[model samples]
Target: MDYIIDVKELRKEFTSHSSRSGLKGAFRDLFTRNYTIKTAVDDISLQIKKGEMVGYIGENGAGKSTTIKMLTGILTPTSGHVRVNGMNPHKDREQFVRSIGVVFGQRSQLWWDIAVQESFRLLKKVYNVPDEFYNTHMADVIETLAIEPLLDKPVRKLSLGQRMRCELAAALIHNPPLLFLDEPTIGLDVLVKLKIREFLKEINAKYGTTILLTTHDLSDIEALCERVIMLDEGKIIYDGALRQLRENWGEGKQIQFSFAEEATHAELQSLTHDHLVVWDQGSNASNWTASVENNEDIISAVIGQVVGAKKIADLKIVEITTEEIIRNIYEEGAVRNG
Candidate 1:
């Protein structure tokens, strides 16, 4: 009903020029131009309600960054419409930006030569943040991100993890209702990643900030987002709850069982018929694996039957991960097109 970000049939295209490599071909190309038009985003439609943390994910060159740029008003759409926080992001850039915050991991937004605290104060003044609110928020942010040690140092002198901590604190100084994050935890160590994730969770819970994150890290999605929108080759391929995506696109359960003795030929056939044995013992006769149907009840039934009939020696249940699910989707998409 109340949506903070709305897009309808959104599309963006870019025109690029290409020329031949050799000098002779270059001379011939002087009178002619080879222009190519590529669509960066194609017929994208999405809506995000307030306070919803969603992951916008895809492989490199999949148009995730282009969509973020359009949503943030850095680039205008080639066609269709985009609205954020009840205003046209491109047309109302000045007023629209006041309601949103952006952080790109590979770029620095803070003042390079100034101390972190100085940059924070400047942002406070720029955003017209009330002194009372700024003071209260600064205290909480400093403690939550543990950036107090880095505040006195110049932004250019801080390490990546320290700078990222300060960058997050700087983004929150304005208290924007909507935040756009592009690979916020990229290239950081595991400990720093954990700290940043915790900080993001607290910010979302405390300020009700709507976050649209684009990342190659599926772990970030698993920890932070319940919903996911997957893009591929300039088109939206999947959008749904994370759990539902896992259930619908997953490879189901795979388990390997090594028995002290093999089951009878009829017993093995019966199991294979219903269970879909993915790997079976030929010469070994005592080792095999089954990729059961993607149903809990079926898995339970098969496992119970195995325990009763076969003398179990070793068993392994392969765990399904979010990364594997996404990889499967991409592979399937490739097959569909090829």
Candidate 2:
């Protein structure tokens, strides 16, 4: 019944000014201002329970960053209400911030000229972390993230991967229960990305740390989050389990079959529904491939038809990937908008 984050009718608006072009128009516009009101977040309401790992995702200009800024107290909402740990984040910034940690992948909180360890010490003083708590947390973080080797190196000299590890440690030094990760694995190689994902999983499992992750990487969402909230043009279009999202919007599973003898296109067409079969071609005289929808009944029917007519050599079914599902959703949105 307890929620770490609660938002109701949350909205953020900004006024942008436009200037006239050309010398004469610019001179005339100097005495006048043209301002337009843009809404960055539009009446969104969501609740995140304790220990929940939620993915906040959207395309560019979808207002993902705006929502996170409001939740973290960096920007105040223009209207509506937001509560983190039962306190208004913007109104009670000091006390509220202690309960949450934020990491901006494109930015650094550590001093550029200082060693990673020195930054941790400075954060200790700033957050007033107890010596025992700091030591215990740091030990766990260092081991989990493998940042021991990079401790003595200046933050500016560390590689992107190493610096990201240090950034995660700096955020966790206070042992905050909630974490907001904005593109935590951006620009990292595959190996480094896997390590970061593993580290996040470990922390969530060990500490039950609630995390709200925003990223362009669908892989991160698939690996780390059970539930997802998708945004489009400052509005939420989907909010539910990852599996459910796929079921609702995903292209069905792809079924591939190889036959003992080559089946002509007309012969294959006679076996299954025309729309259900996607690819119908043979690599050689005895090899052929075909695709079908994911429905069990459909698959069964297609298999029955094909097996009844010819000898089957091989069969494989490929499930729709998370990335493919998301792309479908985006394309659907674009079509609808257009």
Candidate 3:
């Protein structure tokens, strides 16, 4: 299994000038200025095998964009190395450019004044794609993405969903083996987001294109990516299977129950072991939630011990979501180096 993307000890920093305050401070700036160095991306390393769709997630200012920029050859790393498809992206600019595609949802790659088809045509020329291959691939993309009706419409006239589909088509027209998607579904409705997810999954399955995605929408991560790498404060805090991350960060189980009659808080608290009652529905309704340790194994036993079939009306138990798990990891305690 060959790795298409390899990164090692990548680091990036930015120096921002301090703003002058008041007249004295402004005049003092003429003589000297102060600057603060912000570590945007600390030393980080990872390898992505070919045909792998990875979800790269992190909080704001967590260096997600900085890492993307380095991987896409948009910015040179202050330190360390990055190799995509056996080429140094920054050094072999032409070769790298031809072998990859990028789409930033906040920005448009299509010409605003031209019809979607025309922009794709221009891309065909730019990538120097053969006419036969271009036609075949374009037809397939249009059909798969369901952009046939919007192809002839100018980009500016298309709805956000329509434009996103076109944008995806444009990025792949050249048939780059690797795709870098930055928030491809940002600000879209639920239906649109689902549509985009389906399209991306289809392309990856059909073409085996290696995809590196950076997104805030955890649903996108859950829906598309098999592996996830989490970053915080410019460092790789968690990296591995999404399941493992959830197992470690998430409490074992969330147990909820509704009784036919009100139950005392003391009785509920007494049933818990290491777990704590993070939320309670109150005695009036006989509903409550408790964070139980060894949740999976102990929950039922505790329920039996505590409730004792006290005419419970409803009961629900399930594993926590990715969002809740990640939140727990971040909020658990002091940040540790990884």
Candidate 4:
């Protein structure tokens, strides 16, 4: 199979320098230096197929940015190998970049003082995009992102959400087969985020553009990616389907029941020994909450036990969130290491 991205034992390292503070020590430090070697990316390997949207997620300082930089030819790896589209990104940077588009949420790639359209035109000249292709692509992007109204406005004057929309459009003008999106929805309102998500889905389906998305938002993963790669301390801890991650690591459902008649603590305890039940006074003195596995049999058994003793007025069951499952994995790893 031909993979768009193939990484083998990729590693990146950095050096930190420290100097003495006092004048005498400073003078001595001029002659002697202390350096500490930090590994930002450990030996990691990954393969992504053409047109596949993969979520690359991790906590801060987990080497997500470092790996992206290497893939985009902005940073050189210390050791090992990386190949994108059958080419070494760092070795043939000029050619490699023409095949890929990148967006950094906190950084602006547009000219601050220029109109959004002018920025698009400038990118067209820089990338040498043909007139026919440019016109069609820009039109599609403008309509999809709803940026027609903001075309004449300067990049510096647009709101965060508007600027992000333009940023995405600018990156897509060349119609690169691969796209790297780093926190593309950061700092946007709910409505704007939804628009952006919709645009991404449309583009991926229409063009089959392969995407590698990195974000702190787990919802983005749930909405966009079927496969996820989770990193920790410069290493990948999990790489599989999103559903499998939930099945393997996710905590089960949390169920709450509102009873018409108050049941004593002893009565509740006698009903089930498998679940942890707590009286919720804020909702109602008779309401109770239980933490239980997501198994149908277990849930049915618990429900039967409760209904047998008390009349249930209302009930709600909430499944565990992706954030909670990832957090639990990190905490468990820490505990085991300690």
Q: Considering every candidate listed, which one attains the maximal lDDT?
A: 4
**Structure candidate 3, residue pairs in collision:** none
Summarize candidate 1's per-residue lDDT along 1-338 as a digit string, tens digits.
Answer: 98999999999999998887899879978998788999999988999999999999999999999999999999999999888999999999989888888899998889999999999999898889999999998999899999988888999999898998888888888889999999998999989999999989999998898999999999999999999999998898888899888777565876678889865556766755665554545457787766666778877777777877778998888756789678867977742210
Candidate 4 matches the true fold with a TM-score of: 0.86
Could you give the C-alpha RMSD of every candidate to the true structure, in order shown?
A: 5.3, 5.0, 3.4, 4.4
For residues 106-211, what per-residue lDDT tens digits would candidate 3 score against the true structure? 8899999989889998999999999999989889888988889898899999999889888889999988889999999998899888888888888889989999
**What CA RMSD would candidate 1 show?**
5.3
Clashing pairs in 2: none
Model 2 alpha-carbon miss at residue 25, Å = 2.5
Cα lDDT tens digits, model 4, 1-338, are: 89999999999999998887899878988899888899999999999999999999989999999999999999999998899978899999989988999999999899999899999999999899999999988899999899999999999999999999999999999999999999999999999999988999998999999999999999999999999998899998888899888887665776788889886667777788766543334365687776677788888888888888789899888787899778878878832210
Provide TM-scores for the models. 0.83, 0.84, 0.87, 0.86
lDDT of 3 at 335: 45
User: Which one wins on TM-score?
Assistant: 3
Candidate 2 per-residue lDDT, tens place, 93-131, comes to 999888888999999999999899999999999899999
Q: Give the least accurate 10-residue stretch of model 2, judged by summed lDDT.
A: 329-338
Point out where model 4 deviates above 4 Å.
20-27, 256-290, 296-315, 334-338
Q: Sorted on TM-score, highest at the top, how do the candidates line up?
A: 3, 4, 2, 1
